[model samples]
Target chain A: MKKLDEITKRMPPEFNDFYRQRIDFIKASIKNYFPDQIDKDFLDRVVGQPSLFEPDLKATYDTIFLPTQEYLGRGGKVLRPVLVAMCLEAYGADIRDFEPVFGAIEVMEDSSIMMDDYIDNSLTRRGGPCGHIAHGYALANVSSCTAFALSHYLFYNNELKLPDDKALKLLDYMAWEHIQMAFGQIEELYWTQSNVNDITVDQYLQETIARCAFLTFRGPMRYAGILADAPPQDIAVLEKIGEYLLVGYHLKGDNLDMSPDSPEWGKVAGEDITTGRRTLLINYLLDKADKQERATIESIISSRTEDEEKKKVVYELVLKYDIFAQTRDLAAEYNQLAKQEIEKLSVSDEYKLLLNQFADYATRRRSL
Target chain B: MLHHLIENFDTEFLEAFEADQRTINECFEAEYKKLSDTEHLEQNVIDEPLLAWDYRAIEPGLLELMDPFMESESHTPLLFFSILRDLGLDPKPYVKASLLLEYSYFALGVIDYFDFHKVFTERKQDLLTYSELTQVRYAAQYLIQYPRYLVIKNSFELSKAQNIALHKLYATIGVTTGIGRGAFLKWGHDYFVSLIREHYFQNSIYTLNNYFLFPAMLGAIIADLSDAQKDSLQKGFSALTMFAKLRLEKRYYENQDEFKITPPIYRDLWQLLSFPGMALMENGLQVDPAPYAEDKYPWFTGLYRDLNTQIQGIDMADTIKTMEKLETELFETFVSELGRVDLLPATVERLRNCYRM
Candidate 1:
């Protein structure tokens, strides 16, 4: 229920400093890894072209490619790709050499967002019309597939000069992550669609870990491991850390969504409630509410509307139950676990400190 | 007593099988607990109460069907564990492999519940309520997507190539036995009635090949053959298929009157038949025999009598006796081909226990 400014005022100076530095580093890395001019030219030349098979259908290219570029330009945190670069650097890989790989991760993330927004029937993403809304559904669908092809092409034609085996391994890891994420997506679809009320906290954990955590956290970290040829044992540790960190991150996102005054959060607040997404916050509230309160929440969810009044009613119930605090506690627990796992890594102290700080910022950041 | 079939069936394999079964059961128990936890269930309440069944309610009919396999304390994992052990491959990696297979099956069961309900009957409206149907618009989508996740996740143990091959084998079985057969029954149920009424054995046999024999071959491949021996096991699989077909035809004959005369009998018939009878239908046969009445349909009684005559002519008692003998030969042939002479009798006995006919 707290506004972003209020939450920011409550944060310690050191935490703010760490968060600001990370964001700055991420922005600079995006610029360095993918220059603006080259990206535009690449988009124009590759994505902007007419269909190879249907040369006359220039509209297909314009509708699919232009909107994709517009969507990419709308910009996100680029968190996953940043994670890749951080992990690569921590593992002592030359980060500059893996620019294409970083770009591929960003491309994959953007494409997934395009598809997800379409699937969720979301109208706006990052303050702009969703891809399917900007273009048409048919063109958006084609662009989604095109994004994947572009990602694969980036890896296949590795400009990083990775050894043949390492290049293959990188591709394999990317493909594997993509598959795992899709499974998670399917599970999400099942839960949301089925109106399944019996979803437990554990089920929520499993689904989120599969759906969001794998791609957002684990995939990037593991890619870095593969690039650096880190030990399999260390890779395993990274996976656990990724899992915990991502879960915490999702919990925080869920919290931010329920906070009505956080317009800086972008998109829509209470969208999860309106859409009936089975977030940890929703699950927790359902678990804790008494029968009468439970009925009230169920009624709101069943209505499945985005009415401001309905969102306010649900927000009141969430507050009465103290669900936000409980969710934050849970997120803190995971963040702590992630930090513990980070400590187990054989990486340098500086890398460890950076990871711990990032985990803190990831789980606690209130605004850009 | 089951141990007597394999010549050198050691106690370790049994212990290993028991341990793997326990692990898998524990996994399911954990899942079930999450589903059944009142607090969690109460918390998970959505607008659609039925969606809650995703976690909480187990469809009694599906549970009863799955009970034997669930109670048997193993499914594909047990088979994989036993086969991998016999083949001298390390069985450790297969624990995860088996778990993945079980999860895939669990997800498939969820899809099957929706399928049987015809939830997607009105696609546009249903999509509004249950968007998950989009992922599995074609049943083959589940086969392609879910199994690949298992292989990818478990690819740490085997090479990517090996994992793909093994996963493909399982996926193929799912498509052939689950989707392919389910579609056949759904589409051909009316035709099958006409075939039964007219006593069209040749046409029936052709239908049976798709509805029955192919699935039987697939089951045989899963049961008796490894990836390396896929090509070599064709003859063995064919023999097994023939035996399964005859056995099923005999069972159908014995149950023909019940199948034709009583709708409830037909409803229960597939479930009532032991493993061998169901194998013939690829475990997907669901018939409502009510429509094929003698008065309503001209070919009904004649077809019934002809099926009866065919049933009477083949002494199932003798055929089963012959099948038992033939299975022993097939088992021996498979073992010899694998060059695992020591495992021959035990493997055959295991097959015998599994194949009720």
Candidate 2:
């Protein structure tokens, strides 16, 4: 909640001095951002309507509503919306014009989450039973359906006040994003199920970039450009910046699954193995492995292992290739590209500062 | 718990409904004596006026004890509940319970400590509280027809009076937390909502609404909560579904169960029927549907079985049309039970009448 200039001052002094003028650029754009649009009226409507458990009220309470209510009241950082708001500011947007778009993004992100948890079969979330875990399979289905339908209401009903063109464009963009996401998920599932090792590192990286990083960073950046109807050259530059930053995210995102407790993740001075999935690390290792070692790696992975220790040996064998340093250097190269993309933008000096700050945050975010 | 059978309705024939109230009370008195004998349990009971419900509820620290008890595998060898069930204390005679937050544990005041689970408690406490206590009652609710979740779901067609009578059956599910205990005691604050939304909700509303709703009470049972929390919670209807599934689960252990992803679809087809509120069960609790769905529905059932068997190894979309035909047939079957005669025109008329009325 600190003023933009104040927060800019807190950044690395050089970075702050370089980006300080963007305080106005960001401040004007974020003056109207809303994290979530939930209101008392919405809550009341939720109560008044019969739950999927309506007639059987008390039993339903034990089985359905209480579980879901507990989850919502106890939940997350609402980070995706924050990502969207940042992109709007980078484009020098007026916060008033961007509020509806941000709210829509939150609902979209949350609804997708409802579906995501089901896909992952993850048990606990936000310190409570997931909607499905608490609601039972049938009713959990009911809750997801309702959540999906509710998410579209804000935009479709003209309730959020987006302009007709922007609203329609958002619908188009979201639909396309959903298709790419589903496509990426299907690819992942098919690969996992087939137990096939024929997939290339490029395909794996592309799917990860499209699914994990682009939508998180690019979609909102694109949204900001489109809202301002920036010239095509500027839009292209903005997208370039987004793509560069996303590459870094994809390189790091693979290890997100490897817990600190995991023995598979041992100390690696320079060389890192493919974290998991057939990343560039494992692919490089495969290229380097003697035929016997390659065959051995193929046999155990294609089949099942007895435990985590066995899995760690497989991971360790791949680390021998030093593909870890390869990806690390590659990620750094993308970070430089991100810097280059920001410098190419011809926006005013004030706008340039915001762009610089965005580039810095996107690259150094998790590193610091 | 609150003499519900008396205050809520005419239970002058207590001897008839509660054939063993004396034995139930006696069992509880002995249990109380045993609890009093245990130095740890002796401090839990607090004496307060019965009508001062709120005071009586929290005064027991019953919740602190119960919190450890809630996750005690959700079932336990608890005496009061067994006595109540043994005495046939059930919903058909009406039971009501409510959960309220207790004395403020936080000075910040936003967080309700009563609503939160007790994570610090040992697994042994979970053994005593959740797994042992609620699971037993939950198991019984699935196993015993008298206190089952299905019977509660079936109360909709009951007369206004009978509806009230059936509300008490929920008390068994409520018996544990009376104020919810260790609801998710050990569930830490790291997992994300993305995880909750994507992975947890496996079934869609369309599936439940299409297949499970109306005929089954599962939807209504979950819809029973206040509106504020609907978006995130996940619920299942195993309290009824599991009654049958438990038997199936047991058979699995014995290696006698049909091991397949496709559950026996015919159980609902043949057995789903009215609760004892309309028809008495002489021996068992499988709902009998001969009256509502009728013998004619069985031909469609056979067709379904034949279609499933036929389509097992065949192409997926090749069976889509057959599935579509079956879906239509099922729709007709639903309409037929609603007393609609004929198909297209009559179905339209029926829909119109239902919507208009």
Q: Largest DockQ belongs to which candidate?
A: 1
True-structure RMSD, every candidate: 14.9, 24.9
Clashing residue pairs in candidate 1 are: A195-B51, A196-B51, A196-B52, A197-B52, A286-B43, A287-B43, B5-B345, B5-B346, B6-B346
lDDT by residue for model 1 (A250-338), tens: 88888887883354565667777666677778778888888987888887876666788988988888899899999899899999999
For model 1, the superposed segments whose C-alpha errors exceed 4 Å read: A1-60, A156-161, A366-368, B1-144, B147-357
What's the lDDT of the predicted structure labeled candidate 2? 0.36
Instruction: List TM-score per model, in order.
Output: 0.52, 0.44
Error of 2 at A54 (Å): 5.5
Q: Cα lDDT for residue B120, model 1?
A: 28
DockQ for all models: 0.03, 0.02
lDDT of 2 by residue, B1-357 (tens): 111101221232233335334443344344324322323222222112111112121212232322322221111111122222333344222221101001111100111121122321222222223222222222121111211222323323443222322232222122211111111111111111112211111111211121222112212232242222212111222111212222222223233123333223212211111011111111111322333243211222233233234333334442234333433443343344333322123322422332231
Evaluate candidate 1 and give its CAPRI docking class based on DockQ. incorrect
